[model samples]
Target: MCSGFPALFFAVAYNNPRDSWSQVVPIRLRLLRERFVVFFGKGSYGRDTLINTLGVLFAAVIPVAVLPILSRLYSPAEFGLFGVFAALVGLGTIASTGRYEAAILLPEEDDAAVSIACAAFLFLTAFVSALAIIFTLAYFIGVGSVRAHSALIGLGVIAVAFSGCVQILLSAAIRKRVFAKVSFARFCAALVSAFLSILLGASTQYAEGLAIGVTAGYAVCALILSRVVARQYGGVSLPDRAAIYGQVKRYRNFPLFSLPSDFSNTLATNLPVLFFSTFFGSAATGYLTMFQRIWAGTSIMVTGLGETFRQRAATERQQTGNFNRTMRVTLLPLVLLSVVLCATLVLLGPKLFEVVAGVEWREAGVYGQILAPFVCLQFVASPVSWSFYIAERLKLLAVWQLALLVSFSLSLFVGSKLFSAQGTLAVLSCVGVVLYAIYILISERISREENKVS
Candidate 1:
C-alpha cells in the first residue's frame, strides 16, 4: 500500500512544489499499476493453479524422462526392484510421520491441540514399528539366507520418513501463513537431489541408485525445508503437558476416526507394488512404476483443476451449499479431454514406448494405456474425499477405501499369482472402478449435508 516514494525524495531534493509534482507524479501511478498486477497475480486462484500444474508437470516428467535413460542402462528387474523399494519406503514414511491431522488441525486451534498431541504420539508408535523392522532385519541377516544391505534400506526409510516430517512441517508453516522461504527451500532440495543422483559412486545397481537418490534427495529436502520452517516458526515445538494428556484424551476420536482413514488412503495409493512384489517379482514392479508415472502425470493436470475448484468452493460454500457443483463444473470438461488422451495412448502407446525407451519398456507402455481410465477416474475422485474430511465425515470414506483395497488386493493377488502382470493390472482397474463409485456416493452425501445445513 505504500506509494509516493518518488514524491517524497523529489520534494526533499527540490524545494519547488511544481518540480516535485511534475517529476514524481507519473512514477507514482506507474508504481501503483505494477503493484496492482502483483496483487492480482497473487490473489487469483487461476494464476496459482497454472503455476502449481506446471510444477507437477515438471516433477512428473522427471521420473519418466529418467526412466528411459535408466532403463537403457539397467534391466527391468533393476527398475522393478527400485519400484518395490520405493513403495516400501513410502509405506514406512507415511507411518513414521503420522502428522497429517496436525497439518489440518494446527491451522485451527484445538482446546489443547490434543489431536496433534495424539497424532505425534502415533508417529512415535510408528517408529516403534520401525524399530521392530530393524531388529527383524538384524536377526535375519545373522541367520544367513538373505545377504542384503539391511542398513542401506533402513537408511532409506529413515531419510524418507524424516523428509516427510519436514515436508509436512513446511505445509503446516504455510497454513500458518508463512511463505517467504518455502519455495526457495523446496527448489534447493530438488536441485541438490538431482545433482547428487548423478554422482559417480553413489550407487552400483539400478535399485540401489534409486534408493540412494531418493534418500539423499529427501535428506537434502528436509534440511532445506527445516531451515525455512525454523526461520518462520522458531522450529517445531513439542506439545506441553496438558496438551499431551488433555489433547490425547479429548481428541482420541482422531485415532479412532482419522487414523484408519489416513492409513487406508495410504494403502489404496500404494499397495499394488507391495503386493505385486510378493508374487510377480521386481520386474513387474518396474512396469507398474511407469504406469504410475503416466497416470500420475495425468493426475497432476487434475490437481490444477481441483485446486481451483476447492478455493472457489471454499468461498462459495459459505454462501451456497452447491459445492458438489464446483467439482462437476471443472471435472466434466477434463474428463472429455481424458477420453481423447486415453484413446490416443491406448492406440499409440507401444509405438511411443519403442521410440523413447526401446523394447525393454514396451510392456510398460501397454500397461500405461490400459490404466489410463482408472488414472483419470482416481484424479477426479481424489478431491471428493476432501469433502468428507472437510465435513468431519472422514470415517465413512476411510472405511470404503479400506474395503475397496481389501477386495481389490484379494482379486489382484489371486490374478497375479495365477495369471500374469496384465491380469493384476486388469483387476486393479476393476478396483479403481469401485473406488469411483465410492467417490460419487461421498460427493452426494456431502452435497446432502450442505443442503440440510443451508
Candidate 2:
C-alpha cells in the first residue's frame, strides 16, 4: 500500500505532462547530485569539470572569433585543401596510437600505467614514420604530386606524431587529476594556432599556412603538456621494451577492437570531404568544411564535458564496477540540451550564417540547418561514447562503427543518385540521427547491466 503511493503520485503527475516533467526533473537532479557525491566524493567531479570546461571554452572561442577574418584571408579552394589535410590528420592520428593510449588510466600501478603510455608512444612514432615514408615515396615518384600535396604530406605526418604524443601525455595528466595544467595547455594551443593561421594566411595566401599553423600549435601544446606529465612522474623509470611489449599484450583488445572501431568512426566522418571533392568540387567541399568548423566550435564544449566525465567514469567503474548513476545523470541533461540547440539552429541557422559568415556563405548556413540534428546527436554522443571504452565493451563499439560506416556509405550513394549535395547532407543527417539514437540505447543498456551486476 505504501509503495503504491509513489506510483499513484506519478500517475497523477503525468495527467499534466509539462508540470510533471518540471517537478520530476529537479527531483532527479537532486538525487543525481547525491549519487555523484556517493560515487565520486564531494567537490571532486564538480571542480574538475569546471576546470576542464573552462579550457575547452577558451579553446573553442579563440578560433571562432578569428573565423570571420580567416574566411576573408583564405579562399574556398584554400579552405577545401585545408579540410582535406585535416581529414588525413584525423584518420592518421587515431591509427598512430593504435588506440592503446586508452589503457593509461586502467592500471593502478604507476609503472604499469607508464608502460602502456610508452607502448602507445612507440606505436605512434612507428606508424607516423611509416606514413611519412609512404607519402615521401609517392611524392618522389610523382604520383600524389609534390606541388599540390607535398606540403600537407610533409606536415601531416609530423602533426600526427606530435598530436599522438600530446594525447598520451594528456591522458596521463587526466589520470593523475592535473586538470588545470591540461586546461591551460588547451587554451594556449588554440590561441597560438589561431593567430598563426591569421598571420600566415595573410602573408602566404595559401592553405599550407593554415596547415602549418595547426601543426605548430599541436607541437607547442604537446611540448608544454609533456613537461607537466614529466614532473608528475619525475622519478619513475622509463618503460623498457619488455614492459611495453607486455603492456601491449595486456591491452590487446584496445588495438584489436578499439583501433578498428575508432578508425571506422574517423573514416566515416572524413570520407565526405574526399567524396565531395571528387563528385561536387572544391567549392562544395569548402562550404561543407565551413559548416564543420562551426560545428566543431560547438562540439569542443561537449567534448570538454565528456573528457571530465570520462575521467570520473573511469574512476567510478574501477571502484564500483558499474556506471549506472553516471549514465543517468549525464545523458538526460545532454540530450535535453542537444534537442533545444538543434531546434534553435533549425529555426535561425540560415540567417545567422548569412549574417556572420557573409552572404556568400548563406548556402553553408542552409546546410548547417539541415545538418543540425546530426550534429546535435554527435555532440551528445561523441563524448559519452567513451563509456564504451571505460566499460571495456570495445567489441560492441566496433560493431556499431561498422554499422555506422555502412549507413554512411548508403546515404552517400542514395543521396548522390537521387539529388544534389544538399540532398546528400539531408539524407546523411536523417540516417545519422537514427543511428546515434540506437547507440545511446545500446550504451544505456550496458549501463543498466552494470548496475545489475553491482
Candidate 3:
C-alpha cells in the first residue's frame, strides 16, 4: 500500500504539471543543470579549471589504474616505507626552494619574476647540499631508519633536488599561462613513474625501487618544465645580482612568513604517517598511506581547480584589487562536488578497495570512510585558502598554520594513547573537520575584507 501510494503520488504529480512538486522540482533541476553548464562553460573561470583538471585527470589515471598491480607486487610495509620517504622529500622540496617559487606569480614584470625564480634555484642548490650532508651525518650516527634505508634516503635527496626545481619551473609556467605545457609535463612524469615503479617492483620488492621511480618521474618533469619555461621566458640566463637581491628583498615576506607556514602545514599533513610508523607499525603506516594515495587520486580535480584558482585569483586581485566574487562563486561548486565524492567514499570505499586492490586493502578503505568528512572539508577549503597569499595575509596564515600543527599533534598523541589505530583516525578526522571548517571561514573573511578595502 505504501509503494502504491508513492507511485500514485508520482503519477498525479506528473499528470498535473501545475502541481507544486512537479513545477518546483523541474525548475530546481533545470537551475542546477544551468549552473553546472555555466560553471564549465566557454569563456568562464571554469574553462581554465577544466583544462587543468583534464590534465590532472590524465596524469592521475595512470597511477590510480596501476595501484592494484602495485599492491599485489609490493608489501604494505614497503609502501609504508615509501610513504615516509616521499613525505621527507616533500618537506625537503619545500625547504629547498625557501618557498620563493610562490612569489613568481606575484610580480608584474617578467624580469622580476625571473629574478625570484633564480633566487629560488640558488636556495635549492644550497639546501640540497645541506640535506645530503645531514643525511650522511644521520647515517653515520646510526639513526636506525637512516642507517637502514641510507640508499633510499640518498635517492630522496636527489628527488628533493629535482622536485624543488620542478616547483620553481612549474610556477614560472603558471605565470606564463602555459597550462597545457604544464599538463603535458605532468602526464609524461606520471607515465614514466608508473612504468618504472612496476618494473622495479617486479624485479626487486624493495621500497627503494618506489623511491627511484618517483625520483625518475621528478627528473623527467623537471626536464620538460625547464625547457618550456626557458623558451617562454626567452632563455634562462642568470639575472644580475642586484636584480636578484632587489626582488628577494621585495618579496622577503615569502621566505620569512610563507616558508614556515607551508612547512608547518606540510608537517601537519604528513605527521600521521610519521606518527603511525613510529608508534603503531609499518603495516599500519602502509594502510594509512594506501588510504591517502586513494584519496589523493580522487582529489586531483580539486588540486587542478586550486592551481587555476591561484593563478586567476592573483590576476583578478591585481586588476580589480579584489577577487571576492570569483572566490564566492567557486566555493559553491566545490562544496557540492566534495559532498558527493565524500558520500560515495563513505558508503562504498571498503567494498571498492576489496574488489579493486585486494582483501588486504579493505582496512585502508575503512580509513577512507572514516576520513571522508575531513577530506571533503579539506577539498572545499584548500582552493580558497590561496586567498591568503592573494590578499597578502601571510601573518594570519602563518598563525592558522601553527594552530593547525599544534591541534593535529595533540589529537594524534591523545588518540593514539587512548584508542585503537582506527579509533585514532576517527578522532583525527573529527578534529580535521573542525579545523578545516575554521579555515574556510577565515578565507571567506579574508576575501570579504579585501573586497571592502578595494
Error in Å for residue 149 of model 1: 4.6
Q: What is the C-alpha RMSD of each candidate to the true structure, in Å?
A: 7.4, 7.6, 8.6
TM-score of 1: 0.80
Model 2 regions more than 4 Å off: 1-43, 144-147, 304-332, 383-392, 450-454
lDDT of 2: 0.83
Tens-digit lDDT track of model 1 for 38-120? 74466454555565556555655565555556556656777677677677666666556454445444435633333353456
Candidate 2: residue 78 Cα off by (Å): 1.5
Best candidate, lDDT: 3
Q: Write the per-residue lDDT of candidate 2 for residues 238-308, one digit (tens) a residue.
A: 98889989998999988887788778989999988877776777778888898899878877767666876
Q: RMSD of candidate 2 to the true fold?
A: 7.6
List the pairs of residues colliding in candidate 2: none
Lowest summed lDDT over 10 consecutive residues: which window, candidate 3? 1-10
* Ordered list by lDDT, greatest first: 3, 2, 1
How many backbone clashes are present in model 2? 0
Q: How big is the positional error of residue 240 in model 1, measured in Å on the Cα after superposition?
A: 4.0
